[model samples]
Target: MASPRRRAAASPALAAFGRQFRRYRERAGLSQTRVAQRTGKTASFVSQIESGKKRCRREFVEIMDPELRAGGVLLGLYDDLNGDGQMGFPTWFDWPEIEIEADLLVTWQHTVVPGLLQIDGYARTFLSTDEAVLARLARQEILNRDVPAPTSLIALLSEHVLHHFVGSQKIMREQLEHVLAMSEVPHVTVQVVVNEDGMPAGNGGSFVLASMKDRSEVAYLETAVRGLTTDDPQDLAEIAHTLDKLRRNALPVGMSRSLIRKVMEEKWT
Candidate 1:
């Protein structure tokens, strides 16, 4: 039997924690300031904690038990929220929302090409099951919706990804043709990282830097083991710097287009 596939969302646990906190507070008839004063914390801190805008500390959890009078229920809730938020998302399902709101999306694909730009057949091959096909199709809707499109969508794929076929030769050929067609989109830029050049990014792993509508950037990194999402400027800046170095080593846009064309020709022949 196939394992049930899952759609990813940020920790529903954190979301749950927020709901619980608000429910308990209102039930206790305690204003936000009352909770703060009782717990010896600031009103703003209490507000942020309840709203899931910030993480709770062990100290905060301890105070909540005595102040909320729920006999450690609130602390238990805090323990549930202790996990990394992205744990709620399935293996590679973390980037679509950021992509939806991106002003520009710069990606470096060390292994498979990022899913958004993959052809239908290639996506299906990577998934290899009906459930994943549905998930990928839903993700495709992010790009399809008539929302304001990203100002730029740059994809830098390793040459190895082009050389390998995820599915049958026919599917591969069709996929490559689809890629060529996608290259024609005015906002898209595709480049290949050839083996002829020394590795510039030095295998730090694959990552995406999405410049959001607010002009801030978020970064996502994925491996077979897990996925990580972060909007921290420092972390995103470092990843962006590495991707920049890799882009420098990648084939020029025109040459990369020719390479994709050549691969498609050889496949069809």
Candidate 2:
């Protein structure tokens, strides 16, 4: 028999389950706070479960079933995790089915731009020498996709993010030019959160809010520790509120583009 599928698979399934469960919960009008109270779990525990950073216990699923009332789906996922080894998403994380059909992606970059939209040089600078190769190979695959959706990306970059040059000044200059070039893509909207604005973004950490099919939204957050994925309505709502604030504090699109060009000129010279 095929070796039992690894726990890496379980993690993603559980993660997906949390996402869908939250959607259904919102549809059924149950708040996350309410779910936490009913399940006797902390809100952070609930968040971690939804984000797939923590393994959700089977008993908790059963307890949450009628409370969230998902017709037994989330409980079923918990049962599925019983036999596993090496839990967590593998490197080859396929886009969640929902994210593949996203209508818009609003993202903030405190240190660097998101990989999906990064230039090869920029991506390399952000990653370690070991990770850079793998990331480049992945980008090549993404670019090769035949029916890649007309992805709409609203990218916000911090002024400090640009100034903190990762690679050599030469590479950094090229990367800035690359960013300016990406701005010309019809579906890309680029903005810079200048330091003078004095707004604190990325304080809660880096996150991406993607608008998916049927108006579904997914949030992705990353820290020094790990990557987090969630489609929970409550979590998404909170993240969206934070992102909206960042956007308001960010420089206007034209100004950001000009700033990028100016940076390129200054550095390239």
Candidate 3:
């Protein structure tokens, strides 16, 4: 028999909640079939909920909380997912909540350094306002989480990012050094696509793909004035394929670091 297929999540928040629910269920030592039986649903339905392919209703949470001994933990997470917490974010973007729950992050940037890897001065140059700068810095918390669930980052940068001179010669130098330092982290990988590489994939703009612990993926696209986050399976698949192509075409990690060091010595000095 063929193995069952896995599905991507419908949204980042839903995927996060599903992960929490699954963890609690496992802690309670109950199977999806048993959970379904208790809630008047099928094992398939429970599977979908845990995979984030199906929504978990309030009624389901009510039934699950006591059974799983979650002590209202699941309900609290559900409320957070449903709340209006996007007021301070940029328009049409809901990535912050999703980013918090992602176990893997893949980013492709053609212009500036990816946000998570950017230094304070470099980030301030692009963010424009104090609040915006703080907000951008706030997102970096995921990279340094104290918990066991560390977020792994794979950042792909175009060769131009090192030479672009974001703030000043000094700031750029500091920023590049910061990138080098971040790459030393066990969970972070940095690669560069040299100008000669000639537009491998995702060359039009920048995007980030976040993978939840459950293996469901979501994607975010950003431009000069607009940003969008999507959980559509087809969109996520296409983005993933493009990212894979970019990864294959980019310089390997060691060589990329060498390239950065060479640029710093030649240009920044």
Candidate 4:
């Protein structure tokens, strides 16, 4: 069986820790202030961790576990959320709500079409199973949601991606057509980057940066080993700069559409 693809969200374990921590605090009859005082953290920090707005670090759990009389329960959950000195990102499955709630989503897809724009056939081609394809499709609804209005997307792709064959020629043709139709949507802009006799600057990998309505930002990067989601100011700034450079090298909107059509007609056909 194929290993499950990682979806960007607050990990269920992390959310559970938040819920359990809230219960332990309330049962002890202590306010967030009391917990913060005992842990040498701010009341806001206590609230955010308990509410799942922020990740509860191991040290925070170490201090709060004894202070809150949680026995080993809170520490255990923290360990489950983040095991041993490893990098902390794979376990977050909540709170940032990066994809679904973003007012604007900017994605760089070096290999294939962005998930939000992929047709079911093209998506399933590599996803290779119903369950995984469904997950990708579900994420796609984020771009078409009604309650908070549809998300605006700016997708930057490599010229190579348009010509790459994901499946059969028929599937490739349909996928390009789908991309073209989506590009016509009022809020979706698709640009292709073309550099002759050389690879583009971002060829090292593809990643996504989401700008939230609250003026905060988050970024997601998928590596061969794991997926990383971060809101760290400095890291986000670096990814933003990288994205800006790629956009600068990308073809204009009209030229990009023409390229897509040209490739679909000449190569896929």
Candidate 5:
């Protein structure tokens, strides 16, 4: 039979978490079964978790923290890996961490510029609070990291998003200029999706998918009220399909850059 899959396949934080958990268990003179019983989980689940073949939530780590005498180390590791959700997203959301661990990130923006590529000026237009903008700027630091290799981004922004005015004219121009500058980065590709062929836009919603080293993907779906973050296989499949459709109708890299430049000069000016 094939071996079970590993959840912490390439996440450094996750790997470290599993390693530290094992040390704590061993130090406490407990077997996996004993630990599992204490934590109200099956022995197999504990085994899988310590072996890096399974994932756990912050709550699980919280349980393990006191039980294993880890104090707060386990909780800290969990926070480091899955993110603390300080980005105005759901508590269960793994966004910036997902972005950091992902080998490939695909974004479809129907209205605004993709967050990762947005300049401070354009981003402030959407964010009402200074704290929120600071959170966004902090996440952007991942784009600068080289240790785990930069995340390759394929941004498919709708053409209308470019034409629409956000904030002042100067801010809009600056944002597109930032977009163009970032597109020149080797790992980033910006594509403008022009619906000349009239393909349905999945109700003009925006979503992002991060493809990790283990080939598992996470999706964040944008809604009016609040964005939804999901890892459900079916939800990922549908979102992936929609992302593919948007990509198919997108302009080539060079042409997309050209179009962005044209719009910035003509409309923003």
Candidate 6:
């Protein structure tokens, strides 16, 4: 017997595009085989593209543009995916592509819950805008992908994150429960930095350190208005050092969960 075909993991952006492509193809009343025939590829190939296992080729996009009547929508996505610089995602401010491809993700959040770890209600509370909410929800897909190697995430959250009420007490309670549940996932580790620890390292702001498949590293820093992603050796080293120090000061996993539960019960309740 042959082994089952491995499903491909997709970046948040690619996943969104795949969803759009599938929707447009279905709305056009075309089957995968028919689309494949039009594009001169196998049905399996078309399926892979639509499922985000394989990238949509430019030629295929050219054919699909007219077949699906997308009116350049498909081409625009193609350009963005290929990094041709013609189309950019205005709402997705963070480096989702790198985040999805990372083998290890270390995050430090001083205020709110990190986007990937947030529950819908928690996210919706602070996101406010529909576009921002959708973009954040889309980024969560990386945590749920089961194939192409699951990314390991270590999140060091300030204890204040547990006490900070975004929407309501109920929302905060549910958010804490969500985090406790997520920490149970094999690839995810959640730790808390207690307020008593004085000023933690990297108290400057929130940031993410992504260790990519190729052994390269990148750091993402967020500001009031925008985010910055850098692979500069010095920046990566500095951010990595800060993350290491923060992790050292954070509570152990079991204690963190206990703290979260305590906060949920005592404060949020």
TM-score of 4: 0.72
Q: Estimate candidate 2's alpha-carbon lDDT, on a 0 to 1 scale.
A: 0.67
Clashes of each: 0, 0, 0, 7, 0, 0
* RMSD of candidates 1 onward, in order: 9.1, 13.6, 7.8, 7.9, 7.5, 7.7
Q: Least lDDT summed over 10 consecutive residues: which range in candidate 2?
A: 1-10
For candidate 4, the C-alpha RMSD (Å) to the true structure equals 7.9
Instruction: Name model 4 segments beyond 4 Å from true.
Output: 1-90, 94-96, 196-199
TM-score of 1: 0.66
lDDT of each prediction vs. the true structure? Answer: 0.69, 0.67, 0.80, 0.77, 0.77, 0.79
In the range 1-269, model 1's lDDT, one tens digit per residue, is 22222322223334346557777788878888987887788889778766545656668668666666778877766654455543132332336656665678888887776787776778887677888877776765555556565457788888777778677888777777777787788878899887664545638888887765545556678767877776554665577567657767788888999998898797654
**Among all candidates shown, the one with the greatest lDDT:** 3
**TM-score against native, each model:** 0.66, 0.62, 0.70, 0.72, 0.72, 0.65
Error of 1 at 52 (Å): 8.2
Task: Kindly list the per-residue Cα lDDT of model 4 for residues 1-269, writing each as its tens digit.
Answer: 22322343443334446778988889888899988888888999887776556786678878878777899887876775567553244453442356776778888888888888888889888786899999888887776777889888999998878977887899899999999999999989999987764646676577887766655566788678867776655776677677767877899999999999999999998
- Cα lDDT tens digits, model 6, 1-269, are 22222322543345456767888999999999999899889999888777556777688888888999999987876776567542233343247877887889989998999999987888898877989988888888888887877789999999888877798888888889999999999999999987565665767789988776656566788888888766555666677677668867789999999999999999988
Question: Candidate 6, which ten residues in sequence have the lowest lDDT sum?
Answer: 1-10
- Residues 1-269, candidate 2: write the lDDT tens digits: 12221222224445555676667678879777877888888888777677555777778778877777678876655554444543333322345443455667788888876676666676776567857657554643332355775667788888766777666788778778777887887778889986555557667888877665445566678878877766545676678677767877788889999888887787654
The list of candidate 3 runs beyond 4 A from truth reads: 1-5, 8-93, 195-199
